[model samples]
Target: MGTKFRSSCPISSALDILGDKWTLLIIRDIMFGKKSTFKDFSSSGEKIASGILANRLAKLETLGILHKGKLPDNRKTVIYSLTQKGIELLPIIVDMILWSDNNLGDHVDEKMRELAKKIRLDKEAFVNNYTGHLKSLMAAL
Candidate 1:
């Protein structure tokens, strides 16, 4: 969640909904690979606190960015998957990755460099194809 705001410029409004550092990183992790449980997300390098992670997940779910479901075999564990609205943000993430790669290449892996190059070449196609793959996986679940 975020601090309350007084009025709404649409851009400001949207940012307010997603302005927190932890929130964006959480979305990034989900977009990249972490999407099954609190454990998966907590282990991501940003080192989000457990209580904060739970709150942010709840917030994203409320904002329609994520949907929660139970595993078929184990009702105690929950799976978090991106909604179409959430998947729609992939191009934005891709662009951020490209920008980071340009500015911070030395620390990033060769595989990531290659993947970022591919993502930069055709961001829309990459996102569209990835979105389709996620949807297919969701259907299979």
Candidate 2:
């Protein structure tokens, strides 16, 4: 998985992998929405196209941010879970949620707005608790 970097800048380099519109959304779905299978993601409210979802899932796996697996009893079912590196993105995602809740106003969903309030109450605790939950989820996978 050789990715071409646009520049040596850290933000630019990170964007090379995550700057796309759909990549982080897919990550967001896996992290927050608890979406794992292709069908679950395809049925998301954003309605991402199948080709783009497949491409982004592959890219995330290549970048070491996601781990793809199969169900124990159902060989045909594909599942995706976040790696430790991907789990580290929780802070960034939480910050984005808070930022959107503050700036996006009504555009943000009610559930996210509620989450923003919880995040604001104690950001560190929220992140820590959620990170633990995600780690446990990964362990169960």
Candidate 3:
């Protein structure tokens, strides 16, 4: 949504929005971790640059993948939460975990491997639980 599509191909368009490493990392944080603010993202272990984080957050919002707004209790504090479309990417993340553990086993940690196993054990249940968590968090917003 932030830029013109390079081609009419669906893959290209998706890449336009999510091809970069940082975007999905940002999504990973929001979807799986407690990354809800600019500070949280900037301070993550990935150490995403401040400018890059801001731009990615805005781009995700423009693409309707996230909702950025002020916290209800504190007008000045901000929050970034996933949209319905964003939460739909859970399976993709889970799949990537499986793939990473399979092909890049050395790089994946035991925790991630365990998660991938859990996902493999029951993909539907994992997806349901993750999506339910997202919905409940969004409801609180």
Q: State the C-alpha lDDT per candidate.
A: 0.80, 0.93, 0.89
Q: Candidate 2 — which residues are off by over 4 angstroms?
A: none
Cα RMSD to native, each candidate?
2.5, 0.9, 1.3
lDDT of 3: 0.89
Candidate 2 structure quality by residue, lDDT tens digits, 51-117: 9999999989998999999988898999999999999999999999999998999999998999899
Candidate 2 lDDT score relative to the true structure: 0.93
Per-residue lDDT tens digits for candidate 1, residues 1-141, read 454765678778768877878877877777776466888998987788999999999988988888888888999998887888777777777777888889997887686788898887888788889888777766766
Output the number of the lDDT-best candidate.
2
- Model 1 C-alpha lDDT versus the unseen true structure: 0.80
Which sequence of candidate numbers ranks them by TM-score, best first?
Answer: 2, 3, 1
Tens-digit per-residue lDDT, 15-128, candidate 3? 988899899999998987778999888888889989889999998999899999998889898899999999998888888888998999778878788888889899889999
Off by over 4 Å in 3: none
TM-score of each: 0.85, 0.97, 0.93
**Candidate 1 residue-wise lDDT at 93:** 75
Better model by lDDT, 1 or 3?
3
Ranking by lDDT: 2, 3, 1
